[model samples]
Target: MSSPVSVFTPEESRAIKQSWKALTADGLLPVGLLLFERFFADVPQVRHMFSGTGIHGDENSPKENFSMETLRENDKFTKHAEGVAAKLSCLVDNLDNTPAVMNICSELGQAHKMYNVKPEYFDRLGGVLLDVLQAAMDVGLDHPTIQAWKKAYEVIAGATKPYL
Candidate 1:
């Protein structure tokens, strides 16, 4: 149940912990919403996948009618977004526990696979996430923090890819 080696250096771990704390200080829901907004805007091709998620107004409505308010008001969508944020928090909390991190990421991978999420989408989303994190940071996501996040993402994706 244990990974053979740790994935993060001490400095990287500290950077990640500090930045994540700042990033989620307000709450996961807002961070989740911001992530979705960026994801939907940056990856329009993924819109169809969210059609049934009530993010695009309603189940039968066109995506062009999408609104932040619609997503905010939709309990299901909000919960889904919250779930995403929660999972990231789990990973961050378990940073020192490689097995837990692997298991978490693996479960995420399996779930996304069931959703028919493409492998490439993970890579694309990772980039968008970094951008969102950087922009969201008022104190600035410094070099070490960025590198830490990138490496953590690589580990997450690596573990997640097998199930995908």
Candidate 2:
């Protein structure tokens, strides 16, 4: 699908992509862990949502079973987080390709909607992500960077909101 009216400027897109790169360069797994840690901790009850069902990225893994319970420290979880990190990486990398990026986000929203991933959860996830990025980055997250991420997220979440 085509992207909605552009919500971000070229400068904003650059900042968002830079922030993503900085956060995940050599610490994708740890950063993902920290983000999910906050997500599960802040919304403890949501952890149960993955008790029986696996997290989003275990479809073709070598592991037979997967759950978020021990995922905070498990390799499977790291792999899982890597999958998501990779997706976000792709999206950020394609920031200039508006149609492709929006389409990907829309598809992702649809996929998550199958599991009842709601719009609010995206916002929560974004906040947790920013917090983790802020803590992880050497210079730390600045205002422009945060705004860039927020705008990028709004595009994604807004696309996903329809399914939610």
Candidate 3:
């Protein structure tokens, strides 16, 4: 089969790969925790969706009141976040292989659909990922590198939404 056409420019792919390397240099776990932490902070309403993940605190407690510490300490949540980070790594590693990227995202979209993940949440998570990248990286969002990440996320979201 012919390789799928990539929407990302070669420069964008390089920027994304470089940023991913820098972002995960410490390890994927911290980046994953930070990503989800920011996601929950920015979109507390979605916290309920992650109930099965064991990241949030007591169900009886107000959703907004759950301690972030609970999420940080939960093994299941940590593993889940790490898995997400790993998927991101896989995507970056396969940037030149557009079909592989689409396949990974399509599978994720299907899986998340089973969990009742909404189409809007994908954008929210993408926004959170960008925020996390900006905050964690020495270079902020204004840089071309972050801009490239933004483009990469758009591609991922676009590819995944069809399966959602």
| C-alpha lDDT (0 to 100) for residue 107 of candidate 2 | 82
| Candidates in order: C-alpha RMSD to true structure | 2.9, 6.4, 2.2
Pick the lDDT winner: 3
Top candidate by TM-score: 3
Backbone clashes in model 3, listed as residue pairs: none
Ranked by TM-score, the better of candidates 1 and 2 is 1
- Model 2 poorest ten-residue lDDT run: 61-70
Residue range 1-164, candidate 1, lDDT tens digits: 85545678878888888888898999999988888888888887776776667454456677755766777888888998888989898988888778889999889999888778988888888887889777766435566688789899888988898888
Candidate 3 matches the true fold with a TM-score of: 0.89
- Superior candidate under lDDT, 1 versus 3: 3
TM-score of 2: 0.76
lDDT of 1 at 161: 84
Clashing pairs in 1: none
Task: Give candidate 3 misplaced runs (Cα > 4 Å).
Answer: 1-5, 55-64
lDDT of 3 by residue, 1-164 (tens): 87667778899889889889999999999888888888888888888876776444456985456776877777877899899999999999988888889999999999998888888899999999898788767677788988999988999999998888
lDDT of the structure predicted as candidate 1: 0.82
Q: Could you tell me every candidate's TM-score relative to the true structure?
A: 0.87, 0.76, 0.89
What ranking emerges by lDDT with the best candidate at the front? 3, 1, 2
Query: Please, what are the lDDT tens digits per residue for candidate 2 over residues 104-125?
Result: 8888888777778767888888
